[model samples]
Target: MHSQPSNEDRPWTPVKATGTALKGADAGIVIMPGDALAAYTAVAPGTARLTSSRPLCATGPGKISCQGIQEWTVTVRVTRP
Candidate 1:
């Protein structure tokens, strides 16, 4: 999961958002909103839930602004049952 919009901030910066599956990974890992994360997973039949994460740092839109640094950051926790 990765995304680096060429123009993330602008008068008309298209709210870049999308999701894509891995190219060769064999699993149900669906990245959410721009493949920025592995937000969901299907661990087994009829059993699935959202992954967890800790907020390391976040900035953008209204949290914080810089000359050319507009983005959000976080650390996702991978769990297994």
Candidate 2:
């Protein structure tokens, strides 16, 4: 019979938070939100889990500030079963 691998032995991969346009704004500017939790959750499922969180870094609101141009930066550790 085949045996399942242990959690400790599972392969792990690091996931980085990627920013997307929260609203209609200039594509030249790059905004990174400090909220790691929010960023982690934003990641697609079955991708990875937040292992470490980093501070937020962003530029002043652009033309779409009213549209909420928030950004996030998060570090995730993804493991495969």
Question: Between which residue pairs do clashes occur in model 1?
Answer: 18-34
How close to the true structure is residue 10 of candidate 1, measured as C-alpha lDDT?
25
* Candidate number of the best lDDT: 1
Q: Write the per-residue lDDT of candidate 2 for residues 28-59, one digit (tens) a residue.
A: 54434332222222233344322432222222
- Local distance difference test scores for all models: 0.32, 0.31
Q: What is the C-alpha RMSD of each candidate to the true structure, in Å?
A: 12.6, 20.4
- The alpha-carbon lDDT assigned to residue 69 of candidate 1 equals 32
Across 1-81, the per-residue lDDT of candidate 1 in tens digits comes to 854332222222212222221112233664343233432332323322233222222335564343443344333233432
Candidate 2 wrongly placed segments (more than 4 Å): 20-81
For candidate 1, what is the TM-score?
0.22
Q: How many steric clashes between backbone atoms does each model show? A: 1, 3
